[model samples]
Target: MWAKRYLSLDASRPAWAYALDAIIANHTTKSAKAARPRTKINVFLQDWNANTTTRSGLPVYARNLLNTAKKHNLSLGAIKMDKNLKRKLPLWYHLGADKHLKKLNNTTISDCLREKHGVTTIASLQRALRGEGGCDAPIYGQESVRDNCTCTTCQDLRGRGCKHPRRCRQAADRLLHFILPKWNPEDATPGDGLTLTRRRKRRNQDMLETSEGDFVFDPSVTEKGELSEAFRVFVEEDTTRHPPALRPARGRVVHQGKPPVQLKTSSTVFNALRAWKSAQEQMVSAQLAQDKSATLKKR
Candidate 1:
């Protein structure tokens, strides 16, 4: 619960997702069938200083909440703010640095060129950075070795200033692939959920014109999740638009593998949880039966 407390917007998700991350994270972590006791979640919605224009100040809402809590055997309590926090609790462990906190200087640019583009020398860097249609403009940025070659492609590329004219479109393609900024999962703004992603070359790319490298090495980061979420929203929306299309959604069985842990350990944990739940239910039923008998006797 403590690890999940800060799942609310921290620093990793897009601004468009305000607290959806937290909401989804909570839903997912609890969805797993487990018998462990979980901390009860309470909505503390006392707008101490609510807007004056709102109907019936805020006390009425509090009273309504108390009535609802009582009806459901829920505890309703309030805590007063003792002191101001210097910084937000969630931001204390926010992912990625603030944009203004760090600036890219020549060092960073050079490092990025060297590591990602394999430009060892300043000369190669200038040629590599020529971008799109300059001399020797092949964006084989993923090459591990950086030796010059006289292959037909390389020579044909060098001989002609810009290769697009002589069908040296690969050069143009290199620029086309990287011209648009790639989506870094690290840049996922923390918006209230447990965010995670892995890096793969040529994974996050989009281009105005089609090209060879215009494919995502991984789609789970953006495509699968985005499309799945969009699909869910589409289905969840009011069917007033197309009420006839509504029907019970059939569920699909994905995978049925055991947890990726030692089989013995997993079995032990499962058995313990099962036993605990059995005992808990038994005790509750016995207590209820005894209470009922006592009430009958009293009557």
Candidate 2:
């Protein structure tokens, strides 16, 4: 009966109009799960897809209406066939009516459908429903690359050097001043608190004197020569500053039966003293040999 009435409708009517009439008729008499009038419309459309074995046989008008409802942001329920109704009407009509009624809210479905179609407005909504390619508006506008560049002047100048070189130089100078203070020559002294300027001046004077051979030293050989000089100076200074180690005696006074005296000194100091004594002995031996030769000549 529903199929006959559906077929009887004028084919000339707009697809949405026919589909809307079918939805209203099916929902008004029946207890659709969707309690609200608006909700029932969405539920009926969803059921059309669910109950039919093949959506291919659905009238073109019905298909277009379903598409329109989807564009309008309708939520659809799963369609189920009523066995009793299935025997009487075409499978399409029975299936269209019996599916589980799904709830549809206008705002939510509209937003969702809008996103799906990649459009935002209702006129575009209508065009999408009609299967027309509406205006091509990107879902999101392109992000600006220029906004994120760090060097403001460089970015503004593009390929050119900074237009405000003075300002840039001043900023750089200020930054350097903050990081490193200017050296004050007045703060320098001869003790331990020489300013960088004084130290530099002394270094320059030393270099000039060294170049003129005042110290009779080569800066290149200073490292090794300085080590040798330091050793000699340390030994001479130590010997001059400290008295020689005294030997330990067995008795307070000399006695015929007294044991031999023993001398003690640190190994390091002892070795240094031994080396100095050996050098003095070599000098005396060489002088004696020279005297012997001279005496022989006189004879």
Candidate 3:
């Protein structure tokens, strides 16, 4: 049977001597592997008055335990602290120690996966978070590129042209005839309160106003260099004369009839207008030079 001792002391002693004596005295006739070993215990004798305290006696007791175990042919493994022991200690205590000890208790590989991939199998939820999947591809596959075919309409048909002899041009013609309208309305049911009449009217009015402006260049006048300088002057003078309408401060434009007059010169607008005028001058100068060259050649 194994023997154990618990001691309390007021002063320090030679614990190593006591430990060695205990190891020598406690012996059994049975096989070493089958027999339970007796452990030598020591309580440090603390000297309150002495300058040399029992603080250094801790490691001595540890060493004595290890030596006693070794002398008795007992297996002695290195001491291992609990994994969560560092968590109980303060942050500063474990800062310079093992990196695994410094890691947060709540942080895990599952937590990281949840953070990066937007997936959490830890809890029961219906759907995962947004942006979990990568970029989506179009449902109807459409290839971009042209192939051999001399006709303009056939050339416009994208992708490799139909290889079959009789139906090749016919297939290209059918594909070319396909008219894809740009705008698509969201709700198209009969009672869905959606009407195309109002939208069509607004679109037509915008188109008419856009076409009313005289922006087209006359080929005959351009040949004679007649309206080149005059066009430049007209653009500059018109921009200066009519500025954009100002907004009313208190109410609607109809309620106030006129906005507060604040005269300000926009640097951006001025620079743009200056650039336009410079370009116009360059064009006119080039045209005049070309005309003079032509006249000299004729003489």
Candidate 4:
């Protein structure tokens, strides 16, 4: 890769442009499982002080090299300091190079040094320019390149699934939310300051809704009575029984609804129930009359 980029023309960039990247690729990297390596401040200055020649045999100063690396998303250690670091370091004597060139919020060159450094200490985390390609189709829009496939290869599949092994959602987000510049509309912008409004799942909705490009919110789910009917049962029957599971993991809000306002719609059953109620009332009134008569006779 270095040899190929070295031979490219003016617009294609020079070989010296990839020097920091080359240095980084050849060294051991920091990981979650490993201890952090300390890259002192002298290494970059050494190269800068020594006039390293370019591919054209002209002396390319390391100062210009650091600047070029910055343009390629590499942060210079001698300039920028991380806000999270504890001990303070002198200005222009920063520890490592940050491969990810995004400026941290409220951080500057004079702040405490963040321990993000390699053995040579000029580069840290590297951020890559996200491609505007998709896994399934160029039009599907939400997914990113699959299995590190090149942008051209990923966009080839005009149907379903990914051209590569994996489909990415972040690619779609990065592409859409990035603010486009007025000067060069074709140039892709990184999504830095933009905010994405997250799609929320409505309450009592038990359906599988996707947050894809074709998102639609249907409030009719609540009005359909599928949830309300399951939650509030008026009468106890085999149909109202919940699924059995273990000792007793019942639902928290499970309860019977109010009794039916008009029970037994059949006229014969309704009439018989009313007659039985009237007969009981008449018998109670007769018993009360007999007790009153006995008390008056005694008086």
Q: Pick by lDDT: which candidate is best?
A: 2
- Give the poorly placed runs of model 3, Cα more than 4 Å off: 1-265
Per-residue lDDT for 93 in model 4?
A: 22
Relative to the unseen true structure, what is the C-alpha lDDT of residue 220 in candidate 4, on a scale of 0 to 100? 26
- Provide the overall lDDT of each model, using Cα atoms, as 2-decimal numbers: 0.30, 0.34, 0.29, 0.31
lDDT of 4 by residue, 209-237 (tens): 44334434532211111111212213332
Per-residue error (Å), model 4, residue 43: 18
Candidate 4: C-alpha RMSD after superposition: 27.1
lDDT of 1 by residue, 156-193 (tens): 43454333322223332332222111111212121222
lDDT tens digits by residue: candidate 3, 77-155: 1011122221121221111223332232123322322233222221111111111222122112253122333444333
RMSD of each: 28.8, 45.3, 41.3, 27.1
TM-score of each prediction = 0.18, 0.18, 0.14, 0.18
lDDT tens readout by residue for model 2, 30-79: 33423333323222322323222134454555555445544443331111
Off by over 4 Å in 4: 1-14, 20-60, 64-170, 183-299
| Residue clash pairs of candidate 3 | 11-45, 12-45
Higher-TM-score candidate of 2 and 3: 2
Lowest summed lDDT across 10 adjacent residues in model 3 is found at 179-188
